[model samples]
Target chain A: MKKTELLFLKEDVDIPYNWAAGRYGSLFLTRLRDEGKFIGNRCPSCGKVYLPPRVVCGPCFTPPEEIVELGDTGTLVSYSVVNYPFIDPETGSRRPIPYTLGYIRLDGCDTYLSHFVDETDPAKLTPGLRVKAVFRPREERTGRLQDVLHFKIVD
Target chain B: MATKVAVVGIGMTENKSRWDLSLPGLYRLAYQRALEDCGLKSEDIDAVAFGHSPEYFEGVNHPEKWCGEAVGALNKPLFRVHTGGTVGGSVAIAAYYLVASGKFEVVLAISGNKLNETSSAQIGLSTVYDPIMGRQFAAGAPSAVAVQASKYYSQYGYNEDHGLMVAVKNRNNALKNPYAQLRIPDYTLEGARNTPMLCHPLRLADMCPTSDAACAMIFAAEHRVEAITDNPAWVLSAVAVNEGINYVDRDWSKPIGLRKAAELAYERAGIKDPRRELDVVEVYDAFSVQELIWYEGLKLCDWGEGGRLMESGATRMEGDIPVNPSGGTLCANSIGASAMFRKAEAALQVMGRAGEHQIPGVRRALGHGWGGGIQFHTIMIFGKDKP
Candidate 1:
């Protein structure tokens, strides 16, 4: 067999992304990391609670004045079992396949928190099913949605 | 007051993954056809309005500089607009304004996205959300749409079967549209349901396939509309609006921005009853669920009744208000070009040139697009007779 000589060059470029959590996000993450609790801002004008708290309400265009502490328990507004796998940018690895994700409307809050659902069986995951967030170990807490390992059925 | 504007010519590339062609080639493919259709040369165009989503896919900050030459806008005036998914529709509206202002007699509006060049559109879409808030849960468009689908399904008592009909209908419709990316001749409800589930209530078939395509349309002032072609799609009204991204306060199922934009367009067009007056529609159905949601938001039906409306076969090709006669975004999603494709399809319907997908005696058509975090919306109305 004869081999054909070929020349190839490879170049690698790294573009780093740094984002500020801002006032609402900074406080929300700080509380989650320190107290292991979820906090939301309530719009006084329309009386709507925002998860991961927004500085201002979208509809009324009013700045929320009250930051409300919310319970870890909530109802699953919707959920889906991931039958496909894709790259997870966080760890630069593929997200585990067949995992379940859920959107939970926390108690006393109007907005739904989208996060990983502990249950993988689609039948068990139903809208309106009560679930509670399970926090990761204190040492492993990351002050992010991952701070809570996943949401499990309250029952 | 704005001067009257009309779409006198349109050109669209086949909606499929064009890995062989560069971004500029794709733009030229459509621009050349549009120029030929209007029997005009490159120099005849006074200005060019380009549209597309974020520049992440092209791996460039300013894409127009790379693609504008294809449309012959080397030194002449050029405008670019990017409002997420609605970039295409926004471009068309901008071109309409350029002509309506009487600044330019002939303006070419073009937009497209070469999704095949990107790694994965999902990854690109995932990075668009808030880094701290919804990033973790946002598994791109399908996941976001799944959330909307779940909310609508629960609130309106609709199920996957209702959405399946839309999938089957659009896929079947694609069979008639030669440029569509997805053309399934044997498409069925059961077949659609059999597709792998990407998210809860959303299957692979329920989502639009990312394709490489460009759509170009020529907008002319009233005098030029008469001089260019007698069968022009008169632009009755074009309106764009945006709501806040906070899904907490707004209903995800029925987008307020879409409804408000439709109202503005209808009011300006003197359309009392859209369901009764409009002959056809081309809505941004990136997902099947959005198609149903838009039916309600467009006031084609009452709120929470879109599911029933879809089941009624009212929006089918042979139905009263045939929507997506060109297979819609669900069949071929070129992201930036998707909205412009809708506008082009609506214009084709008004011109009575939509080949096999043509609805008989169609007079008026509506084109819609939704973008941003489901916030920005654009609605354009087209009529056969000059408005």
Candidate 2:
């Protein structure tokens, strides 16, 4: 046993994920963050509203005729408490757990939009609870959901 | 009036990694087998109903258009069906309707999935939920199933052991299935229990493997059945139902779509007791816990008695009512092909062509598929003799 010697072996490989930066719908979120505005598409056929705007209206199968400006105030339709921690891409580490995720019905928009919530208590996050978007500093805006920071209790 | 319909032929490729075949190649394999099985060619097929999940998984848009020619749907009546994970079963029901409506003499129903084409199917599935509410919190399908399993445990005092039994039993059943992609020689309860957890309560072994496979079934109207095969699996009933995608009011623990779809299917099939009337069942069991949950939803057993059904060997190969004789999605899962496999397996059992895993004396069988956050459901009933 004393005479035995050990050796270590290692290998290196390049793992690449070639994702297009400005392809498809990536530009849509960038504009929203830069402009500090809420834009949604209006269906001409059925007059239904689409938030974050889709190219075609699902019910009518027609393209959106016009863009409408939506307000930050909305109601929380439903929510869940995420107890599991997730890794943050920017920091390359896990974030705090027990964050609230909810579906918010934006003002003047027919369809509800999903977003993150600041409140952690499950009881406080219920359907029809009024809330407002809390945007990050204008200098820090990057045309993403993080630009809005997170939704906080309006009342 | 709805015309009567029957499954004249059914064929499925041997489930495997299938590294050599493309999506179109996989479809042709099953399509050719089904045509030969029915003693007919592509010209005999009046219409075709294609089933596949999202295009993102295959990294292509409108996959039916890509594989339409191979399925022999070129310039013919072709309809694409999508219902998340349950697309396969939904395609069968769609084909049944074409024959039942008296609009087509025979319809070719086909579905397949090539998960091997993608690096991570779980990453693709994460985008299926409501982008705002569930998207950010998405843990993929396994985690979502784990949430439901956790809720089931909290509501009923079921431990992790119940899920372990289901994993062991289904893996064991796959040994007899020649087409099964994953076949474990000797799987024990303790081994299943010790497998590493992906999401809480759901271990690595508790989930289905992603495979490239295809399943096809030929449905014919009453008059055309005799021309195809004498041992036709008569379609007693077929039903597709959907619930609200964002129904914030409903309970997530027990899916409402399953209940509504089961009720309508049982009504049309004139089934008073599914456990006694149905000889075999092919349920959507992408996750091990789902099979147990479906046992109660399908009324094979009362609510909360699904664990007992597995433990008592009621759903075993030789049990009172064998479930998933084809090893189910657990053994071979091509998401889009899974639901179709369920329908094809049920049809095969009724036709007495299930090979080693065949349930003896199976007369009537039940097939089910559900998908999209449990919002979509499809159910079909098949019998050996005419209804």
By TM-score, the best candidate is 1
In the range A88-117, model 1's lDDT, one tens digit per residue, is: 655556788777778788899988788888
How much native contact recovery, as a fraction, does model 2 achieve? Answer: 0.05
Show model 1 residue runs off by greater than 4 Å: A1-13
Tens digits of per-residue lDDT, candidate 2, A31-135, equal 567777777777888777677666677556788768777788887765555554454322334556656666677887776566777987754644567999888
Writing each residue's lDDT as its tens digit, candidate 2 over B1-387 gives 888899998879887777667789899999999999989999999899998887767777798889999999977999998888888888998899888999999999999888877666776787686443335555557656765676565456676788878788889989998889889989999888888766666677778998889999999999988877889999888888786554323444566678778888889888999999999999988888888888988889887888888889999888998889788888888888888888888988988998999898999999988788766778899998898
Q: Candidate 2 chain A, which ten residues in sequence have the lowest lDDT sum?
A: A6-15
Q: Among all windows of ten consecutive residues in candidate 1 chain A, which has the lowest summed lDDT?
A: A5-14
Model 1, range B293-366, lDDT digits (tens) per residue? 99988999999988888888999999998989999999999898999999999999999999999999999999
Interface RMSD measured for model 1: 3.1
Q: TM-score, chain B only, every model?
A: 0.98, 0.98
